[model samples]
Target: MTSFPDPVVLRRGSADPQAPLVVLLHGRGADEASIIGLVDHLPTGPSYVAVRAPIAEGGGYAWFANRGIGRPVAASLAETMAWFETWLDGEYAGRRSVVLVGFSGGAAFAGGLLLAHPGRYAGAAVLHGTLPFDAGVPVTPGRLAGVPVFVAQGDADTVIPRELLDATWAYLTTDAGSLTTTWRDAGGHGVSSGALAALGKWVGER
Candidate 1:
């Protein structure tokens, strides 16, 4: 088994141990601090934890090694997933609910987790990133049945390849059988106020 770095977690919201947990993952070349700010735009009931990715990259952090944008190496992804699960199971084994919110590269990581474990998480929000393809996760039809997923994509995004993005949108909406909420913005690779508003509402609903 591959060893991983110790996780760095930043917390916000309620201190109650029983509070529902929301894990926020940042894009590549970013840290926990980058996604922690998103807490201000989301609902207040859950305890939000921004988790820094374990792999160091360009002075920041990455969840896994990748050949290109949205193309994660299978071995690297599996190793990191194991490392994350070790910490996650230890911290939230009996928690009532745990949700994931990820952006860009982090979104792909979030998708990998959801696909790998199926019902492990209550819900997930994928913003501006594609799901992991051919990365050792089952992508069969209805793999995510009953999972509540929110996907927001920028129509003008150039960082990630368009084909990958479209394929992710199709799988999440059609094949995954998830209760999905989708949004398409005319902007670039970042979140917008409208998307955040929709996300806040969706988070509250789930």
Candidate 2:
């Protein structure tokens, strides 16, 4: 297991011990507080726990930073994964399921972890993010089979292109044989009400 430093968690709603579990991850340069704000827009209750990445930046944190699709995954990936594993073990000890949620850089890290350890999560929602790329890392279907995934993207996203998203759709559904995906087509680089609504609906239908 990779070793991750302590993560900052932003608790909200109820502190009830038995609420459904959802782990929210912020994008690069954002803190857990900022990420937790999205919980206001999501279906909230006592069961949510928002976690900030351990990799601290000037004003926020980052799971991992890379130049683009071909760049090397930062050294922090392993440590972050370890940290997440410890958190999951402790937080979901008795829970049957968990929704792993992330945006931007956080989303990419979540995608990597879920893809590599599919059974660890009940489902994953990635907003404006993509699969990770590293020298030895390979995208395999068995890694995420049977998992339900929600991929929300804006058609106008300048950072992650539409073709890349299309390829991701193909890779998860075809190349990796594991997981079903629901995609949203909003037009921008950020999440929108429509996408959130769709995400909420998907969470329910799943």
Per-candidate clashes, comma-separated = 0, 4
Which candidate's lDDT is highest? 1
In candidate 2 the C-alpha lDDT for residue 140 amounts to 58
Question: Which segments of model 2 are wrong by more than 4 Å?
Answer: 1-4, 65-75, 135-138, 161-163
Question: Candidate 2 on 39-122: residue-level lDDT in tens?
Answer: 777765536778888776768877764566423265656567767877778866877667788887777777777866787677
Q: Cα miss at 74, model 2 (Å)?
A: 6.2
CA lDDT for candidate 1: 0.93
Question: Which residue pairs in candidate 2 collide?
Answer: 141-176, 141-177, 145-178, 146-179
State the TM-score for model 1. 0.98
Where's the lowest-lDDT run of ten residues in candidate 2? Answer: 65-74
Q: Rate the local accuracy (lDDT) of all candidates.
A: 0.93, 0.71
Q: TM-scores of the models, in the given order?
A: 0.98, 0.85
- For residue 87, model 2's alpha carbon misses the true position, in angstroms, by 2.5
